[model samples]
Target: MKLSLFIFLAAAVLGPELCLATLHNITVKGELLCDNATVSNVKVELREHDTFDPDDTINAVHTDSSGRFEIFGEEDERKLTTFYLRIFHKCDATHPKVCTRATEYDVPEKKLDSVYDMGSISLNLQDNKELGRRYDRDSEECD
Candidate 1:
């Protein structure tokens, strides 16, 4: 019984490491745009379908003033088979709205031997007609 318990414990710890060894480092670059223009100060998040929870967020990055961002993660054939980009627009100084419009990149399963560089993903913000009308009303009220 003691020997069996030891073997189980060892496998539990080492099994994950062994499985993750097949993963390669991947870099994804992308740009966030709003109103047909590049948007700065946007938050970008990369989530894998195998682990879609917040705890499984493989990589998180922010776009620069030019709306350019790069996210780095372990490219695992088992984990990163399907991934999606979550873009958030900082509308206010303290609030960030989740831009539902996002770009999904489907990576080839068999091509995990090397680093996969997903070049430039473009994201467009969701058009909120209400917000536009509210802005117009607020401006009119202020004037």
Candidate 2:
């Protein structure tokens, strides 16, 4: 029957569309750097901006010895997303100032239509000295 044939064709078309909307796993690999140099033991996080809580964190990762990191995630198309690579120096027990404050680097969101290869996402901690100075000024004023 023509009705049966039409129904079958409709299912075939709709099935692929439904599957395409599902999230696929992605691998993102990159180098972590500080002050334009390679850094080890850095923390990397894949955070989703939630509508309910703006400042709440979702997921996190850490870098290896060579400053290389890989994160597996499903790309979401509905919302604006970004991953952050955070760098922190190992601190001594007695001297807090010996370790630099944590710095965040933004990772570009992957698109749903394509696979993402992060390649080399470089970070520069010293490049924002002015921003750090501004923070110090605000803290001094608060005190």
Candidate 3:
């Protein structure tokens, strides 16, 4: 009987928070380019930025042979969702120490619930400050 009372109080306290969950959906499409050339097989990941917790990956996909990709994701979040695209490629990887360059692009909140077309994105590491570097375990040298 005591355990049942505890559970009831717990649910009563948390139920409202759970009920406040909202569903957010977004669609993003774009083409990747490197120096006016199409970049295929590049990894594109849709992520939700979090303040206190690790960012969540909504979906991951690779650019097609034409360097175009489309991703759709949905999440049940209690707060407003902030989305971004993380593009992983070796476009400007020149130094042997660098393997892959990760670039980020923020998605505007107005674009939610509708298709956001990024058109053509040319990746230049020097011009982009949102660049991150990491190495591929299989390859020791940059491509």
Candidate 4:
């Protein structure tokens, strides 16, 4: 009886922690701003990088009135994975970063402990061919 009780107590104490460590619900959140002003109604997407797909995208959440956006995802297949965030909106003509262009945020394996706040990502509304450099490079070569 004593041994069984000890075993039960040990599991009761350690089971939850072990479970929590194995799986994590990594949430990505951030704000979009253009020219120092909050951009609303912008479509923010979460692109996942896994062995099965190059850059599998999901969710098309629009920015709230405060220009904030958020998304939830599971851990990556590899230790170092990328969660690319592409933004789009009607202001494509004004904001070069708009129009489903890739703005990546690498969610490394070590950072997958809990919710990750990407902070305020600002766009200067400038045009540049090298906008999605990281994702572009990975697209050509991601195993």
33-81, model 2: which lDDT tens digit per residue?
A: 5556666776665544456656334456677888787766654433454
> Tens digits of per-residue lDDT for model 4 on 105-137?
566555564677878877555452224433222
Counted clashes in each candidate structure: 0, 1, 0, 0
Clashes of 3: 0
Q: Sort by lDDT, best first: what order? A: 3, 4, 1, 2
Per-residue error for 128 in candidate 1, Å, reads 16
Off by over 4 Å in 2: 1-26, 35-37, 55-58, 75-100, 110-115, 125-143
Among all candidates shown, the one with the greatest TM-score = 3
Alpha carbon lDDT at 101, candidate 3: 81
TM-scores for all candidates?
0.53, 0.47, 0.90, 0.56
**Which stretches of candidate 1 lie above 4 Å from their native place?**
1-21, 51-55, 75-80, 90-143
Checking candidate 3 for backbone clashes, the offending pairs are: none
Q: Candidate 4 at 12: error in angstroms? A: 34
Question: Mind sharing the TM-score for model 1?
Answer: 0.53
Q: What would the TM-score be for candidate 4 when compared with the true structure?
A: 0.56
Minimal lDDT window, size 10, model 2: 128-137
lDDT of each: 0.55, 0.52, 0.87, 0.62
Residue pairs in steric clash, candidate 2? 35-125
Q: Which residue segments of model 3 deviate by more than 4 Å?
A: 125-129, 136-143
Better of 1 and 4 by lDDT: 4
